[model samples]
Target: MKHHCNRHWTASVLICAALAACGGSAEEERAFVASGGPDTPGASPAVAGAPVYRALSTAPLAEVSLAPSDVDFPNPERGFYRFATDPARITATSLDYVVADGQRLVYTPADLSAYRTRDLPSSYLTKLNTGFAHLRKQGLKAVVRFAYNYPSSEADYLNAQDATLSRVKRHIAQLQPVLQANADVIALVQGGFIGAWGEWHTSSNKLTSPANKIAVRDALLQAVPASRQIHLRYPRDLATWYPVPPTVAQLLAPSPTAAARIGQHNDCFLASPDDVGTYWSASPAESAALRTYAQQASAVTGTGGETCAPPVAAQARMACEDILREGAAYHMTYLNRDYYAGFFAQWQAGGCMAEVSRKLGYRMQLQAVAHSAVAAPGGLLAWRVSLSNEGWARPMNARGLALYLARSDNTTVALPLPGTDLRQLGPRESLQWSGEVPLPATLPPGSYRVFLGAPDASQALSTMPAYALRFANADTAITGVQWDAQSGRLALGTTLQVP
Candidate 1:
């Protein structure tokens, strides 16, 4: 059985700690709802040089050229330690204020546009540089929706589809050179409006005939180079096949029982109660009814009983999800969460993110999750550290965590601190360590070297567009550094274990 990922909200980390680690909103206000979307009345779309309700896909990126900030981490451990991750690409978010752990100030539609069009304060850029530098030292990549026409309703984008298309073409022309120029700012764009909140699909956008859907997807797939990545909204259903094996007739009749062609299915199997149970597991009656429905639907389409029964619309949102998931996957495109209308229309600052965190029983950060997938922090054997590397390219430049620990001998091991780094982290290569030190035993542990470097070498910096300056992974230093006390190493948590 497919198990649903545990849906819980992670509690917010203390802001007191984040205050120093995190930077202020790029401007007096955030430009757009970085997430959430659907419908809006009176919203106009982008026109040539026209200021739309939100910024377009083509916005200048905040140049991460500033000094690194030093995080004053606590050494003695007692309470649960905490630190905040920096915003990777704070282009012009429009996330309605989401009061997270302490307080999360997102952007408004107007503010998002302003951030893009207005000037960047020297101070803000300085602080941002501090964060990016720290993350770079650790070698990680940052993923953020720094550029987009997000938080705006799909209705407007779609209504303005002709305009939006032209706008994208223009944006693409500009982007090609900029992307070509920068090796650090990996920009992401979706082909057009997608998902419940623009995630990918679930509503009217999901209504396309398979053939049409494929056509639209193919065009998007062809737009960018094999090198640069384009982000897609999730519940992606561009190219998914059924789970059922080939028809029993084929299995029984042929020595060469090749798997049925993609999207090709046999409705004859639905005729048998046992076969139906084996396939979809519905009751005999449900099976028979599905078989009959498939036969009729197939006859209407002339595709030989388009057996959508097994891929029931009620349970199988496959036909729709494929547009995002498989389409992007096949093209090696990155997939962002399905930002949908349901989310945007109903989003309340503290309520929505908190609800999602609580539903999952934990807080979630898109960039952080991806980074943590590789290396997570170890609890204070008990020490906290703040590391900042201000270079460009690092570890695929993912953002998650960066920390360090000393061995009884005097060697220092780096750690990818939790919540401290995300997308912007790779650029910062910085980390602020926090938490009370605790050790299971007083005995001397082996000298260790820990630090957030890059994701494994399987990934290459050049593979993706050079968005930022990639950095070399941290070097192992201070082997056998002495520790102060006894300790039990606890697994770092992206999410806390809950009841």
Candidate 2:
């Protein structure tokens, strides 16, 4: 496969001669000449002598270790303690407080209980928009859910808590504009608006039927932008839409269909063998199938939730060993850190809290990098990166990867790595991306610092430092590579000279 370079200017004849001297093929020289050369107007003519071609290969001088970070940094989509807030209650100060506590994800449930019998008020819709604006300003994303009620008592559970199917659809239509407008700040939308707490069960309106569930799921998929996914409360609900589990190839495919966009959220995670009816199957074989599907599907789509208090018999499964094992198996991205206080305390006392915190999402660390030591303007600069994802899951949201060339003056130019997708880098998976990118013909000869950045795919947040992915590697005497928080780039600790 031929990898096309994204340079605007053409390679000069001198660089072609240098390439030939460095053992490049005749066809490669012709391709570069055709791309841009003296034949073009205002193009610089090739010099008589060939430029120096210096190839350089370097690995970390010190041993690269996978040490967990003790400091909390802002990594967009994945993390612990999804701070919950009502749309009306969200304020910049409140969000700042959460950010100060190292939380990047917020959970906001748009309460529609009062409007169940009618359409959502204009004021309520404004509150929703305002809340999203706050999240954007605070450099945060939200796990949004629109639910009718929160049943706190047995009597409340027995009452008609949610609107009818027709009303639910209308409400979704009303919220569509807000959802699409603020999709950039939305992490994922929970499949809510059905039962109490929107867990897709025990609906007083009896909206839990298979047909009804499918309707709500489809509506939600349409209401939310295709870039964002919808998370159901149970794995069985997803199996209803996709009985056949996705193969490894499909899960790793570049583009996903709407069906693949539906994921799961287990509110009562690890509460029981079935996770409090999350996998509601009496038959052992059927239960096994559901569990397997959840594991495989969540690998691509994403999954996470809070821990419920387990019974005495189920407490064994809540230990550190089980937690880590199952966390990797299901590919959890985020978990509610506040609800299960006892379990959190237990993990701390048992000496696994730090590791759990470190591995909650995508903790990518640089292993090595190789590139050309020197190159002429408009010449091919071969580059390669070796990295590993140490976290339990890859980034579920869309992300763009680029190699940045920055000058000492802080002037920077980004060369997009078109085909590199961070979502494909799974948990515990190592990926090496290598390609040749041509330096701009107008680029001045200088020593440039090379850095790598994985920014949010959306243009609106792409340049924001808080939305950029951070590497797990720390800056120390041993490991030269370090994450630059101010610039939102990972310094490769290597330099490229353009002569």
Candidate 3:
């Protein structure tokens, strides 16, 4: 039970005496008592000459269900990386892939018989389609990457017999049907099928050249749908083709170009001075330009990869501070959770695991909300919602934002909130939007609590409240505050009285 002391009650009584002597309206004093009045011991004491505005608690909530990617509420577009298609890979708490996971698949293109014909075996097709179909069923998305070989591969997988440009084109062409069909579950595709480990380096075909890189990238772009983006290995790879990347404003603009669709994937993050050739230039000036490109591109497009080497003996490894700094600067949306267990182990040991987990993707919180206390059934219900982003990246996916009015009978009416685009909510920024939704003329006349909901626009998971975007705020319980913990909807606490 909530506990309050008599000390605040005594202080409020003294303040009421002073307010009465100063000609305070009896109606105003009565209003305060009606609104969880100070007569309830332990209520906040009013200031000597302050307006008696009714205020509710705005304190930060505990790190319980509100945390990002938690089992109950899975937010999209950001979170820890996962390597395999195994559903068992999720954490005991089901925190992994709350945003999305990285799916890196390798193939030996040398065996033309395997992919030479349009008549690919149903088994091979099943392998490709099954993972993505499962992701769709689970209500998840993934960053997909396909490679020809690895850093260490069996001799049978050598590039001497690998697919040539023509064969690679045909391979991508064959994969087009599956790729387009699964675009709903695919976050983006990385330009792979090149150098060792598909990092676009050390290829037997010398695919590192700018011309070859462009050709491969163009082929992949054609293979994947325009709705999806393709990530490059290095900054110069993007700069070489586009010459000029999109500005922050341009990235947010409608109808971005294919050039603007390109993103970055730094595999050797924090491994060396040049990140183990992820940045090949020796000149510091050139390195600075790459950094500038990465930060800018990542703001709009996705930027993510894995750590290659953990620091040795007190070196600047991927610590909690570095995670926050780089995540914000580069707007990293995802990371490989498998390879560098040691790096993350250190983060866990340092006691910042919770912070990293909470901020890995987008952590949207309600800063303040203002709305009318009463309205007619057919009247306008106006609201001003102030939200703050505490995560490293913005939500790039499309989601539906709507107002939920729930009656005492446990029924809810969903009113579409027009002109609300959540993708514009940038990292670590406070965004405020005000809108008036027209209440249905047929809405039952009763006391209905107001709530905000962001659901998958596809309507595939509309009934799944756990799949909704959970906000980082304290008032989540429906009975007291009308918050549906199963869904990420917020109950504004103020009731809308309909006459």
Candidate 4:
């Protein structure tokens, strides 16, 4: 897929400025509604002097670069962490380790091996709900998977052990309600429930066939919420299921289709030329085509996985340079930090672990901002902001952006940027947003602090600071604009005055 690294937005600033220059008359002023409430028109008398426009810009610090962060901070649905856990084992105490380690995502593999031949029990479903509740309370998200068995021995791998197609379908139907209820905490669901360890291999019932795979795919697409995505084990599987890869336009469509929602996961990443059959192709041309498709598909839907031990000859490919190159190519969002211990040790010894940690997912930073310093009650508050994404991928989930005005009395007004989806902000991209926000005529006259925020798209978690996206600016001392953990906002180090 083509990488979109540069985008620009120009708001109707000229129109608003023209009206503001006309004595800021109420009749000429636009009717504006604050996010918190509707607008109330109030009359404003004409000013006697020229209109004053104030602007503020960031200053550089000697010690650090302002565009990308080196220190680690918890952001949703990204970064490295442990995978594979039983639902009932997740508890507040168990999560202490995750928090202390500076992680915000976990993988939950719900074991249904016992119920492969029958329906899922209500008690087990409740455990699933309870596990997600724990994650929500701890300010974390889960990469979910449902599997019948985890085969460890060579014999287990050789045997066909998963349930028949009918039983798998029945189980998905039973678990749909639980999945829907906790969609807020689920980052994405792995396309599991077939083969050993749910990696879609070694299925005794031949579930790997194209027909059976499509059936399972259809069921999963219907089971999960439209806002979430499902990840399959290999790129070839997607190529088989969807003979024609989706266009960049279709993948990024406002309402994505099932094909767009399916993503890729590489369990044995970088272990071999084809990652140990994760990209099975009969010819070099076919392999290139599958990889190109994965790159395009994952650029929008998202992709992730874990590393495996390479052979003696392939050890060089596990080096820092190789990993970094492939990571960016795949647009990887997360990985298994604890697995394949030797490779991680190599990363630490090679002085690339820190870089890997910071660049795994989206690293958004505020480059600069310009805005009007003073305006009448109903006049427009014009603003222009420059932002950059320094990481390897865009945010896989939905996010909403807004500009906020707050007074000393704790009164806050929000002006949400309509139709601004951060998912479109590709890796290594820079964007400029310029817009005019209409102020309510009845807004009280005062000096209000300005802030910018990227909060969750869901109303239930929008106000929670835990789910808010924090910028990569170092601190208030280095960059005048600082991250406010308490309010989940970036204090822009400027204010707007109203008379």
Candidate 5:
């Protein structure tokens, strides 16, 4: 009871437009592959041929910040510059990049550092703000982290000095304007500014003390708006304050507080027993408690980090399977591509790289879509959409889902779906959504192709496809209408008849 169409590669939007205009008498549907290939490598066969579903192909998806980020210090040894001062390297394989802030802040006196804590000079602020604009121009978002110093040796780590509480607070206060101005391009901000390299360890200051940590955390909370989350270096850091996870009742009510806004990042992820100082526990019982707290807390908040040098038995202990399993358990949202190259190479050789990359963050795939075969203009169209999240993490931001009606004449109308909040969709979770869409009376009478779009809630980015959510579905083309490349909306692979 299924028909497959041959896949062809053409950049023309007219082809999609033509597909959108096709209307037939048969009350049937055909599923076609957009990428002309099997699902993303390692996808289980169970979901195959499950209606017009999208399969993540062998391509790097955007918007999800992975490894080898865009921002780094000017390393003479590595032949790298501090920031992207020249043209961005636009490669087919690259996605979003990580911008680790404060790398220019040396581990010396204020005059020795390129940036001073007393005040973020106007020139420095302008340069910092330009990075976001550059990313926007390049069709990318930044995974941001800030640190005042990078320790080169154990002696430096032991002797490192951190900025005063007043100075740290002042720096944050100064950066508020830039943060607010470029919030759109910033994916998430890591809680930095403590210890060496901002990992919140080996600090000359007492930032690690429970009371001081709370004060600093509160400052970060107030500095960044509630819309974005501030991730901490350790799970115990957050558990010290927001120890208990949000109850189901509280989550159902959807009450979000600043305390709940804190998330986790394991810098030495999967590198050792207890992940190299990430979790400091003496007994198995205590370790279980910390892990439980982190898993529960991360269910609602974001978690992401990178793996350090694994032990000699890394292949046996830190295999791809273990990494994926742990990533799922921790709800990890991002990873550092620049580090742990050898481990990544091992995964590639072991035939697990594609699966790991495809499911890195939020991998949402359409399972089945049920809808009316025919509907009059300005009439009711009931739809039931089933989606599966096969990724390691859920969407941590507020996103809007809507039905896109692409007419034969290249005109499009977007209708928002009520009660479709993507934040509730978690990894390995199946979402069954049903809604009645009242077609706009102003809609023209013609055959239309129905499409699903997860657009940004921000007006500035709602129309930009780079910021839109790309579903795991395969057939994204609409043959009957010119495709909006800027939005990357997915066609439902079926047409609606209107007489």
Candidate 6:
């Protein structure tokens, strides 16, 4: 699912790309798929099989009995690396799965909880505002690649019979106003890496075509102030991405070459029973499953393609191996062969969510600050926050705004009362507020998840995410906060507990 990168792909290259989709569709899904994939010959049949993907609680969350330690990164290195993950394995996880390319994300309760529960080390979040934050500091603006996660495919994009241009036009029409509003944060549109969450495929639902790619990219380019430029980077794979410094004709070409792509982009974490690829020339079962998932994705996105049966582990490898060989000039990476390191390490029967977090770099994060000496016991914790509305629009209608506060006991508490919530802040109009919470007289002696938004509170376009507070030595709590330049302020908000 590599979005409309315009990367060059021979029919054979596209055929073999089945394995490379991140999340292969995580990112062919820009953030998931390394670069992207292409349609393949149909699969043999459907194999009915499944994995224990932690099913979501149908009813409301009845308060999970989480470990006292949550949200704080167990490792300091993870945060530093996730933003700039290795390109090799990054594409292996479905091309750009870890972090989709054109997708814009606001923290959700699930994400916040996962971080807290896993005790994500300082690595994934900000130990200090460096790297990406530094990029912001350097005046390099960022634009969210707001692509919908549907299973459309290139087939639809290129559907000459269908009035797809109208649909695309409507999408651009809808986005134009929003883009104009958040003009500050938005430098240019990278178009969507849409389809199957932007996986560059034409089967199942996520589909796009050379013509459609031109339309989307043109839309993005047209929206920006010509002074700024756009490039579809992020979850890119050398073999699959559109080469940089493209020719004007190449840029205009519906089918461009991605074979010359270079550099680090994305290919997030892949721990799955779910693998996207068509193991053609193999068994019916393997072919069937890939077909089904593609269809499932297709049904959602309106792209059309084939379906097959479920694949076995070897089949998964077979499907992936088709495109990940040196001789083939197709390269890919997986967690490992057999996946003992990926699944067995976490879900080895009764490993629990924490175990999954462990392999996920969750456990790599340090535990809650159990024994830090609060330097100034009497100093009230205060923070400075800046909300830079540099995005394409005033996204937050202020539906839900609250700082999710957790303690060392993994106990969740919401901390929003009357008179909280930011209204519409135009482009550069950001909001900065300071709130206070008293530290418990006796620290419960655990970690903390101090958040800004409420459960599933993703609507708010808050630039910074609610983060875990590390009581390094009492008097000090560290969080992965963001500094908003447009607002000319530092975004900070977190509660404290002294254990």
Per-residue lDDT of model 4, residues 314-351, tens digit only: 43367889778888988889888877787798788888
Give lDDT: candidate 2, residue 42: 23
Q: Supply candidate 6's per-residue lDDT for 110.
A: 9
> Candidate 6 lDDT, tens digit per residue, 287-323?
4543343322211111101111223444332222221
The total number of steric clashes, by the backbone 3 Å criterion, in model 5 comes to 19
Q: Write the per-residue lDDT of candidate 1 for residues 137-209, one digit (tens) a residue.
A: 3222233222233435424544321113233234334334333333243322233333232323342334234
* Pairs of colliding residues, candidate 2: none
TM-score to true structure, per model: 0.27, 0.85, 0.73, 0.85, 0.73, 0.27
lDDT string, candidate 3, 1-499, tens digits? 1121111222244335434433446545422221223443323344465333332121111112231223222466566656643221222333334334322121111222334224446566555676665566555666776655543443434443234566667677877888887776677787776766566766666676777777888888888877677877888878777767665455445666777678888876765666666666879899888888778777777577877663343443567777767767878777777766776887887877667666766777766555545555544454555677777777756564677888988888887665556666778787666544556767788888777787765566665664577777665554344457665577666576766
The candidate that achieves the highest TM-score relative to the unseen native structure: 4
Q: Is candidate 2 or 4 superior in lDDT?
A: 4
Worst 10 residues of 1 by lDDT: 72-81
Which portions of model 3 miss their true places by more than 4 Å?
1-74, 86-123, 151-162, 310-316, 408-410, 476-479
Q: What is the lDDT, from 0 to 100, of the residue 104 in candidate 5?
A: 12
Name the lDDT value of residue 127 in candidate 4.
78
Better candidate number, 2 or 6, judged by lDDT: 2
Backbone clash total, candidate 2: 0
**What lDDT tens digits, residue by residue, belong to model 2 across residues 333-411?**
8889877777787788888987888788788876655555565576656555567888888787767578788889887
Error of 5 at 18 (Å): 34
* Model 6 spans > 4 angstroms off: 1-163, 179-199, 203-207, 218-275, 278-310, 313-355, 358-499
> Which is superior by TM-score, 2 or 3?
2
Give per-residue CA lDDT, model 5, range 1-499, as digits (tens). Answer: 1111122222122123222323212231231122212332211133455433221122111111111112221110011112222112323222233224321101111121334346667766676676566666544555566666766764677776677667777887877887788777666677877777677887676777777677778888777756677888887777767767753233334546765677887777777778877877888788878889988877777577777676545433367877778877887776666566776887877877656656656766666554545554444454555677777776666675787777778788887876666766778888767644556656666788777778776677778775667666443333322224555676665666655
